[model samples]
Target: VSLQELMEPEAGTNRTAVAEFTLLGLVETEEMQSVVFVLFLFAYLVTVGGNLSILAAILVEPKLHTPMCFFLGNVSVLDVGCITVTVPAMLSHLLSHRPTISYGACLTQLFFFHLLAGMDCFLLTAMAYDRFLAICRPLTYSIHMSQTVQRMLVAVSWTCAFTNALTHTIALTTLNFCGPKEVNHFYQLSCSSTQLNELLLFALGFLMVGAPVVLIIASYIHVAAAVLQIRSAEGRKKAFSTCGSHLTVVFLFCGTGIFNYMRLGSEEASEKDKGVGVFNTVINPMLNPLIYSLRNTDVQGALWRILVGRWSLT
Candidate 1:
């Protein structure tokens, strides 16, 4: 049978299987295209430069050789991977008049995009817990969270993220995208589907993403409570300062994430909604390292020391 016949076997039907999709670039105006291209290009370059500098600073500064910097390094790696997954494709589409993505390519992009995003989520939570232990239980922190334990935590975070992405991607792969292959967003992997895939995706979102967020919140709450119990003003200030940057990142990351996913079920989602989703995914990954490094004096000093030839990798 022909492709159309296989898609709609009944006579006089008006459907054919959609084998590919056209991603509606962010906007329709040619002027807007150039503007967005330049803007995002600058952003992408800055993100890459900032994260690479942070990674280099961490590696060169022996003072940064700790579990915290190790975790930060992983976050930087995830940021680069996450931004790379979407920015290149997005930039290409924005610059070109006609933009298209193959079905397989869309799925591949979706897989890595979600993979890095999931890793960021879990890693942020791990970072929070790490800070909590460091601040709230300084004496036993090393004993409880040794180097081996920290490595295990990081490994588990990446493994869980990959598994979550794989589950969503596999579930989406089983979906049949037979028509209307035009995605009305810049960088999403949405597909035509029956109800089963939607339900599975929802379940996976809750289990993999939602559960970790809850745990993260609980951890920070305890951290905050511990900080409050500090009798000395200097101790309270120091503890709060240590966690402030992390808290800012956590809120920005999780707040945008929850907002985006909550709207997935809404039938009335607007183009702006998709725009915000793309903005969060493409922009926030790069911002995480900058926010942390800029806000934390220790990280700033480490970078300075590395730059001034005062630090060595050995």
Candidate 2:
């Protein structure tokens, strides 16, 4: 159905129907817009290329076929999706004098963006649990994190993410707009009361962001405890090192995501918020592959094999 059908006012209501939304994207001045556009374009390219390389390395290398690597591949795909949903459109808008997006396009972007973002949280929590099992219960790690279990975790993550994104998108569609439909980080375009939307966002944000964060924290707590019980300092260090890349990514993603979503009461997007948005949307995705590659010997070796023509599906 069309956006008009979805977003039409009630029969008695006198609200203006919003056909499109003006995107006051990060910068205002032409000079700054050009500079931001170039930087974002470069960042987008790097993010896509880096994530693709990670996916290839995981697929090509037998050594990197563990549950951790499986989840890493999923993360790479989500990172690519997350960046793609927003950056390309933003880049095109940067070039336009009037950077407006149709109501349908805006909602579509919101759906995919939130879907992937929610998956990021759930997948990270899954990865954290994988690490916890490997470190804390090594004897049962293989049994608990079998191929079947891994796929189930991924399936659940995707299901939950789709539900969360769809809920928000549907909630937004129920609101009626009067005027001044400007979308910045999030669309607050409705002249109608957004109390339901805010409440819904807060509730699902807790489920998608807060609960996963708590689980991640709990998993790491157990992991730390298990690592500390190791007799050798080298063994403890080695155990903790396994978590390095995942921990870094968790901090970067959860930090910005919590700041952006948790404060549903705020209406104004500050400079700090925009900067955080850029980092979350663009910089963070590019860093994921780098973090995994540099910090992970298996991924590095897999990439090296591909680079040197030794990689084979066999």
lDDT of each: 0.74, 0.85
Which ranges of candidate 2 are over 4 A from the true structure?
1-13, 179-187, 310-314
Model 2, position 268: C-alpha lDDT score: 62
Clashing pairs in 1: none
Q: Looking at candidate 1, what is the lDDT of residue 177?
A: 50
Question: Against the true structure, whose TM-score is highest?
Answer: 2
Per-candidate TM-scores read: 0.88, 0.92
Among these predictions, the greatest lDDT belongs to 2
lDDT of 1 by residue, 1-314 (tens): 00111133334755344355666666678898899889888888988888888888788778888777888888888888888887888788776664666667867987998788888888887888888788778899998779898888878978988897888788877765554333333222333545776676678778666887898788888888988988999998988877887778788877787777777645464767866776687678668777888777878997787767744554
C-alpha RMSD by candidate, in order: 4.9, 3.9
Give stretches of model 1 more than 4 Å off: 1-15, 181-183, 186-193, 309-314
State the local distance difference test value for candidate 2: 0.85
Which digits, one per residue and each the tens of the lDDT, describe model 2 over residues 1-314? 01112234646766667766666667669999999889989999999999998999999888888999999999999999999998888888887766777888988998999999999999999999999999988899999999999999999999999999999999989987763434345545567899998889888888899899999999999999889889999998888888999999999999988887764456665678778877888899999999989888888988888877844554
